[model samples]
Target: MSVELTPGLILILGALPVPLLWGRVRSIYLLALPVLAFALMLDTPNGVFGQLELFGLQLTTARVDGLSRFFGYAFVVAALLGAIYALHLKDTVQHVAGLVYAGSALGAVFAGDLLTLFLFWELISLASVFLIWASRTPQAYRAGMRYLVVQIGSGLLLLLGLLLHFHETGSLAFGHIGLESPGGVLIFFAFGIKCAFPLLHNWLQDAYPEGTVTGTVLLSAFTTKVAVYALARGYAGTELLVPIGAVMTAFPIFYAVIENDLRRVLAYSLNNQLGFMVVGIGIGTELAMNGAVAHAFADIVFKALLFMAMGAVLFRVGTVKGSELGGLYKSMPWTTGFCIVGAASISAFPLFSGFVTKSMVMSAAMEQDRFWVWIVLLFASAGVFHHAGIKIPYFAFFGHDSGKRCREAPLNMLIAMGLAAALCIGIGSLPEFFYALLPFQSEYHPYSPDHVTAQVQLLFWSALAFAILMRTGIYPPELLSTNLDFDWFYRRLGRSAAGAVGRFAARIWQAFAGAAAAQTSRIVEKLGSHYGSGGIPARMTQTSSMVFWTTVLLAAYLLLSYF
Candidate 1:
């Protein structure tokens, strides 16, 4: 069959000009583009097309398959919601950046070869950093710089790994890779960094909170989800990711609990959510892969919704810090309700999106007899409910009623939140719609009585624990201080180390200059003493004594020769 241009591709490419030419238009086009893209993606065929050759390397620009379709659908939905959330902002830079970032992620998922994936990967990094920078604050600028550095670093590693893999395998196809090879390991770390694996997670927290309200919405959707897609494509079933993902799921809770910045807390929560997908990839079975893809789909929805709610607060209240916000429900009841829906979904409450999706991954873990893995995942689930599902809304809307009476979010923001909240409910009520899009056949049921009862018992008990802890003053309250993460190494210790080295070098240079000056002074003083006008050597050397001595030596030499 002849290659055909997909509607999704057309919409994505066509939307590029909306921000460029119409700077004054409201975000209507932004909201419409993703919906159009989704409409087009639903009709596209599942196969490779639009092939081209670059420098003798075969590149497939459009390759639609089950896995790619899953992620592509999520991207379109996320972009739509993000555009709705950001409608109040007039900065065309962020709007354009958000579109390009979304397009690139979609393009990356559908790419048929490693070279194509790498190209779109770098495009995402380059395009998305502008979102953070659009905040127009010094902290945002610095955070954007760090974000760019880490993203570019990931791109470089990915490029190097692709080249090495091409050399080893003589092909550039995107497929499963084993960690036994050096190239595979390089590729793994590239995905790991974007996946926010442990120490590499600093960029998410550093940059997300610093972004403009609209920018953070876009920031939360595409970057890490794309990384998750890449991992699902390249490193499925790699045993190492199991433990790495466990740590990713477990450790972010402590930080999120104590974090004062609501957006940063969400960023930590985002890291924790990625762990579920990572575990699915590690399980490497058909059902597990299905769970991963489904969770990723659900994650993009609810996470964007949460960010939307938080972004709306930032738009109205001028801050998203937990300590600075409270009692918003009175004035912004619509926003408060939407936020609760998002929180319910994230907490995996029954009849919510996360309930339908996250349970698949947990079920997959249990199926594999991963006892410890299941236990860790259970604790992480509770942690998710504790930090993101409860604490975020609790502090921002209901806690302390800080007497701040801000207006509700813009019309577009509420519409976006409403749309997302509806989807969260829709997906939960009918998971078949989501299950049908999975990479593998779906045999899992999320609503069994035993499963529902068990989850409720676990999560409700966790909530009770949280309530008791708070009532007795055992639970830590959000403070007005920054919680340190991996970025501390570079932001704090790294800069301090550089400063100390600079100061030490300065002191060494001063010492060397002083010694050189002393030596020069001694040489000059000795020369002046010996060669001054009144000095004996100065007076005699230029006089006849030198001429007499030369004449005597010459006469003696002549006499001796003659003898």
Candidate 2:
């Protein structure tokens, strides 16, 4: 490849001329850009590119390696699929934002230096929020703003970390930044915020569901995974991720169970899925890292598949609320089929994409004798299958009919769903295909007898419990209510706290102003008596007052001499 050519930059630059094109030419150009990027990525040899000196420091703009290549492939694939899904629209801004967002993420993943990574990282945050704002609703606009603040805050943390890191290490290379120093800790949390680590996670759940139907597909694909890649690259085997990952896997499943919005349910499920990858990265073995990368790969395809199916429903019926949607299968059978495939894939059902990948993390946990953590992961798995697999489909496609009929998804949407569905099956049926793209080599098999049997039993019992609860009418019915998450603190208390702070500040300013005004009024009153037209200074301008003052001064001087 030419020295001037960067796989990600090509896509970023390719977006520049999109507004100038018209009709078929533009659509073709949009579709070809990602494909062209994929070609460029494939052509990138395993070496550095665009190395330069900046402020007397070596900056690597491009670093093509096994890990970067895998993520690059995933990012472009998602971009291609998302572009095709969005092809029916004539909105240039969404199209351009999608390309730029994907390109920026790709660039960050391949960055060899912290500076290069930070630049792309900030660009990605700016670019992706446009996808959220593309919905053009007050809610979407608000969510996009919230999303931008959190994302930009994360970028700021990264900048601070990088500056301190450069000072401490005298190098800006982005590699093996364990949380042993102040700077590394800052960088870790920066990545952690993006990775949706527990309480810091509300931004993903908030912003993604508000995205435009097509935009959510793009939103779902890149941001968190790039953070995951960063973790895998920097903080592997840090030990802290063990409990963090366990909690991530466990807590979100409960929130998912009660979520009213199907898209939000998927958001929680997305959190649950990341837990497995985090665990694998914590394990930090060859097999474990492979598991993390492999699971991330499958997660993107399946999650995009789920998001696409939900996006299709949103496009057709105008809402993805579980309470509003039911019996969609009768109107949109193909989309229903695609949604189920994604549901199964995410649930880690036998012969699904998730089965081959998630188990590696759990298995790695067991190998390290983390038996209790393994147990928690097991329960989380069962919980995931229940909510994401059963609830999403049962509510959206097969529940009580809501007496609504709509046309099938548009052809382009259908094609995109079909493509993602195909990937879901392809990776599940042949795990080796996805496994080949992992960062490390391992001999873990996902289909052993014990593994299959244990998974089956866990799923069976979970399904049985779900049925019993439903039969007894004890399961929580879908309600038109927003359940509070960590965002509640911000949306409610944080806003209140902010208001209180503002009010207190205002009162302090008012009190200060009042005292100053009172003092000034006192001064003005004294000055007015002394210097007003009828007062002494005003009268002293006359000849009689001047002579009286001069005579008084001479008398006082003569009295002092006599004394």
Candidate 3:
């Protein structure tokens, strides 16, 4: 197959000339690229294409299976939505980077082998860093560098694992890569890193909030979703993911609660939501996998919607810090409504996107008789409602008035948010359309009496708890202070350790130089005393003495040469 015909390649190659175009034409082109790519993807028949022989091994460049097609659709829609969101921007650099990053993610989703996946995987890091750097702030620059390093590290681990897997199994086909070998373990960690697993997740929170408003929306959409898809494709049914997913879902709630930056809160929320998909994938059943994919698809829209709302706030108000924002609904009513929609969706409100999808994972856990996992997930569900569902909109739009007013978000941004908000409600109210796109056929329903009652009760109680905490002054106030997270090991503690090591090394070098200087001085004084004008050699004025010295020197030279 021609490489240009590939769905991802279209967006990538199409983005190169965006700078040459101007104004409305550029916007149309930018939006059309993703739509065109999506059309091509839809037209491409299922099964493998773009086969090639490399080093006597066959490589499949494109695999349009049910799984890949589902993720591909999600990526394309995200790209289109992101393009619409960013249409108000004039920065061609961000434009190019966003498109290429989206295309790279699509490429990875369609990749048929580990080698092919690695190519697009590294490209994703390379292209996406530009989104962070497009912010052109000192913070964004540093954050982008860190994000690049972590992403590249993931690629390196994937490369190493694939090499080992190829050696052990003589194949690099990306299938159920269980952790039964060293290679499989490495690959699992690679996917985990991209998935923002536990301690490895600070990059998302650190770099995402620092991106350009539009850039962050794109960032929120692609990278982690690709990781979730990869895990679903390769590591589903792995028992360990159950516990790992539980931790992923549960731990972020604490940090998000105290986080002053609303965007960072969403970043943490993104991690929490990923945990649900991870749990579904871990179950490895048809219904479970369906739940995972359904949730992933739903999440991309609502998460992007949340990011877009925050981005609009940042674009107009100059900051998204919870301490610095309040009563925004008075000015940005559209943005406020969209943000609330996103919050409700993420919180699993009865008529929202998360309600339909997140329950699938929880139901899957319950069906498997995983009592502890179910409990943890339930706790996480309530916790997310407290932080993301209630806290985000409450603080940004209705909390203590910051006495700041701003114009509404741009029309383009509002349209993008409206589209995303509609998708969230649509998926929730009419889940059949969404569920039909899943990889597997499942009869699981999302609107059961017990399910609705339990979810509503959970949300109601969680909201009530937040209300009491606020009224009683028990909730952590959003203050202008740095909240320490796992990144402290590198950002603070790690920097301090590095400084200490550097200072110690400098002292050691100083001592060694001092000792060497003293030894050299002593040797110099001795040589000066012996070879000075008043020394023995200077006193040896007689010809016989000189000849005797010359003969001795000649003899020594001859003896050393002979040896």
Most accurate candidate by lDDT: 3
Candidate 3 error regions (>4 Å): 1-5, 511-563
Provide the lowest-lDDT 10-residue window in model 3.
1-10
Judged by lDDT against the true structure, how good is candidate 1? Answer: 0.86
TM-score of the candidate numbered 3? 0.92
Candidate 2 per-residue lDDT, tens place, 299-318, comes to 99999999999999999999
Q: Say which prediction, candidate 2 or candidate 3, comes out ahead on lDDT.
A: 3
- Score candidate 2 by lDDT: 0.91
lDDT of each: 0.86, 0.91, 0.92
Better TM-score candidate (1, 2): 2
Q: Over the stretch 1-563, how does candidate 3's per-residue lDDT look in tens digits?
A: 33423578888889899989999899899989998888888788788888788998778888998999999999988999899999989999999999899989998998889999999999999999999999899999999999999999999999999999999999988888899999999999999999999999999999999999999998998999999999999999998988889999999999999999999999999999999999899898888899889899999999999999999999999999999999999999999999999999999999899999988898888888989999999999999999999989999999998899999999999999999999999999998888888889788788889889988998998899988989999888999977888999999999999999999999999999999999999998898899887678877878977897899999999999998
lDDT of 2 at 375: 93
Pairs of residues clashing in candidate 2: none
Candidate 1 per-residue lDDT, tens place, 287-405, comes to 88888888888888898889989988988888898988888999899999999999989889989999988888888889889999999999999999999988999999997888999
lDDT computed for candidate 3:
0.92
